[model samples]
Target: MNDNSEIQDVELAVSRWLRIGVIISAAVIVIGLILLFIHGGSGYPDDYYPHSLSEIYSGTITLKPYAVITTGLILLILTPVLRVAISIWVFVREGDKLYVIITSIVLAILIISFILGKA
Candidate 1:
């Protein structure tokens, strides 16, 4: 395949990957909602929900519905991060220095935002 074709293939793959990630995340959330409906999630108005990774993971490992929902939401949140990482890989492989640098910066900013968002 020519360079253009190869690039197209990569782009297509990236798009499909993102689509699949979103679909899977959505499905997970739907399942979690179903579980919540069946098992009944526990939370009073005064209680704050679990939003931290550790809390979510601990609950999820125990099959807690709300935590499962949080896991799905986290997966949805990670889709773009995965996309950016893939774009960086593609750019590097293509020797597109400008794009590689720009994508790298975007990735860095994304990481920083996640870190700061948690604080």
Candidate 2:
């Protein structure tokens, strides 16, 4: 197809995925909040919460409202990262090396920030 059409298609696909991700994240958070209200608490001590992926995963598996909320937050954080990674792929596929490089750097920095934030 024409370049403009192709670009529109890519944009639509990316936009759709981003929308889906955000909707799912918001739904999860809402569910978690409902559970929290039903249980009358976050299921964690006032000063304690899931601080790691594993902890969040375990807590979610156990149906902990706080963990579910944290999982939703993580999903929200990851949605943009997913979009950037997709942009890198689209750039590579279109033979746009400069954007590929720039997008890759952005992804790398995002990952580094996450790691450092955890540290």
User: Which of the numbered candidates is closest to the native, going by highest lDDT?
Assistant: 2
Give the Å error, residue 90, model 1.
Answer: 0.3
Query: Candidate 2: TM-score?
Result: 0.96
> What TM-scores do the predictions have?
0.91, 0.96
**lDDT tens digits, residue span 1-119, model 2:** 69999999999999998999999999989989998999899888886988889999999998899999889989998999999999999999999999999999999999999999988
Model 2 ranges with Cα > 4 A deviation: none
Q: Distance from true position, residue 55, model 2, in Å?
A: 0.6
- Which candidate leads the pack in TM-score? 2
Candidate 1 lDDT by residue in tens digits, 1-119: 59889989998999999999999999988978888898866421346678789988887787778888889999999998999999999999999999999999999999999999998
Prediction 1 TM-score vs. true: 0.91
Off by over 4 Å in 1: 43-48
- Shift in Å, residue 4, candidate 1: 1.6
Distance from true location, Cα of 100 in model 1, Å? 0.7
